[model samples]
Target: MGEEIGSDHFTQDDFREFGERLARETTLIRKLQDEGGLSDVGPVIGLELEAWLIDHNFFPAPHNQSFLARLGSEMVVAELSRFNIEINTPVEEIAGEGLARMHASISETMRQCASNAHDDVDTVIAIGTLPTLRETDMSLEMMTPSNRYAALNREAMRSRGGAPIVFDIDCCTGAGEDFTTSYQDVMAEAATTSLQLHLQLAADRMRAAYNASLLLSAPLVAISANSPLLFGKPLWHETRIPVFEQALAQPSPHQRVTFGSGYASLDLVEIFEENLELYPVMLPVCADAPDSDFKCLKLHNGTLWRWVRPLVGKSSDGKPHIRIEQRVMPAGPSVLDMMANAAFYFGVVEELAEYIDAATAEVPFEAARANFYAAARHGLGAEIEWFGKNRRRSVVSVLDDLLPMAERGLRRQGMAEHLIDKYLSTIAMRLASKQNGAAWQLAHLERHGDVHRLTADYLAHQKSGLPVHEWAI
Candidate 1:
């Protein structure tokens, strides 16, 4: 999905040709599944962190292009909005100091970005939604000058029957409020940033891994909830969840960005098939050579923004592998906080996957979906239903019982003792203190009575490399 294309406008013939290739690639994927051609490697971890470029006033600075050009590095790249950029980390095995390595990699990369920042740019910060971002800041002019983004804007409007996309999010943070606005472009989606984690799994385990991801979505959101405000109005603990979904609104019953309609019943191919049937080809570039690699199928799959996304990639040995990209967590508060969130995800999913059948059978899929939205709206204060229990449990109680399970799970993965203790302890303290990023932001806003100052303070806290729980109001 991060890849750019030359043309956004496609003819009917282009769609027809793309569809034919998609069907062929789908067949190839199934054959690969049957032949056990998918790599059976151990789990690997990777991360992508999105961030904002801000000026002295703490407002979004639309200078990502100049900053990126001056930086001249592949690790940092342009994002949807000119004010935003993404930093990619090298994939590492999820064991023995891997978490520490990730923390170092991210810290160093962020430092390089800061060093290369433009003169007009005060600093680059990572947060779910920039507290100083205004509705007018999300205009089409802020969008990155790329055909892919432009096409997305055009196609999103076209899908709505040419009606302007209306983004409405109403929730209670401190006081109740509603954020209602209309946009002709998709830049509103850019206001929200994310810290996306990728975990590669063997083909056979892909189904269970993806299903476990869905089951764990709510608890993950609650633990990681960050984007608490949008355009200075307090909303969901992770306001990015709704803001991004509604920003890409279409007139269809199913949305492009979703938690998923149901569990992965049989195999990973089912997901690709759903993509082929349901999603229209937004970027229909003709593949120069479309044999075996399934370039067209991959492109189509990229367009469908499922929260628990199934991705196809090739290994260094040229064997194809499958990875589940967990798209729930928001970017920043701090690098250490981001690493903690990833550890919780890996540990919990690795341990809970053993009970998938029982979990799915006991907790209804609709309840799981509802739990996700509730957690996004309420954060750790949400009441969620667990797998084996019929009674609803507050997220705090759930984490109290679940943190030990995650610790045991990390042990099973041979994760370093010191790394596990450092990261998971952050999560535990956050739950105990009720001071995740969103909580910290809300607390500061109430005390300081100015969002710009809070943002500046947040950046200072991030630079210190302290976890969110330790950040003071």
Candidate 2:
């Protein structure tokens, strides 16, 4: 979805040609995997954070074009909506000071972005959903000026046969009523933002790492829940999940955005094969690149938007590698909080990937799926089935048991103990206080009964560089 196309309209012949190229690329991927051609330069870490630009009035600011022009940084780019922009970090090795360097890079980029947006925009903030954002702010006119977004909206509507995308979400633990609405295009997706973490790994470890991500999704979402209120109504702890899923809803057995069919097997190439068989190509913009690049396949995979997505790319040494894009976590309440979430994910996934085969056998894929929605709905208080146990356990308890394993995983990776502590301690404090971003937002709204004031205070705390756990209600 990042790549742009020449035209929004596609012909039958275009689809045919793109499909042929995609198939050939899939075959090439299999051949490479069988021949041990994938890169072993692993576990590289990177991230993309989608954030909002707000005006002085604390509402969405549609001035990203001017904002990006002023910022003039390659790390910052436009997102689906003008009110949103994505900040990307440089790829680093996940050992020693790698995590700290990521934090530094993002912090510097954010500083520059905030400094550059003094004109039409008030300042930049990173959160799951803006409390003051309204339905009118998500119209097609607010979409970023890009051919890719234009084609996505056009193709998505075509896939649904012109049916309006229906968004129906029930508040699980809030006083707000159930919310139901519809949209004629995919603009509702703009209302939700997230922090997407990337971990590049060797092809041999891809299957285990992918399965570990699926199993860990529940705890990750629960601990990182930052989105609670949408349009003045308190919704799920992390409302971004349902909003993004239903925003692009279509009448197909294979949803464009999904948890996936089941856990992966021995070979990761099976996923690409399934992509070929099940999903219809949304953007048939054929690339003029080599077959080894897998351009068409990559574009098609991008459209799928799996919660845990697999990416194929080349390393600095020019050898192919696979990476897992963890998309469950929201953008943030603070940079420190976001980095802590990344550290927990990296360490835990590394440790669990070592024993994923046995782990998956004990916990069924259906249970993992159930755990995800449960956590998204109820946050830290969510009770999820763990380790094939007949009874469910609170997400907090599950995380407490896993923190030690994560510490061990970081140690095994040769990360400095102090650096590990710096990140993991933030998670510990959040768990102990039970004051994640969602909890803080809900509590503040309850006390003040004002979304605008809630947002204003949230921004103040964010600017103060305090983690959500430390923010006062």
Best by lDDT: 2
TM-score, candidate 2, is 0.98
Clashing pairs in 2: none
Whole-structure CA lDDT of model 1: 0.86
Off by over 4 Å in 1: none
Question: What is the C-alpha local distance difference test score of each model?
Answer: 0.86, 0.90
The true-structure Cα RMSD of candidate 1 reads 1.2
lDDT of 2 by residue, 1-473 (tens): 37667888889999999999999999999898899998888889899999999999999999999999888888899999999999999999988899999999988988888887675998999999999999899899999999889989998999889999998999886578999988999999998999999998877888899999999999999999999988878999999999999998879888888998899986678888899999998889988899998899899888889999888889987998878999999998999999999999999998999999888887799989999999999999899988745447899999998898789888888777998998899999999999999999988888999999999999999989888899998
lDDT of 1 at 31: 84
Q: Report the error of model 1 at residue 97, Å.
A: 2.0
Lowest lDDT sum, 10 consecutive residues, model 2, at 385-394
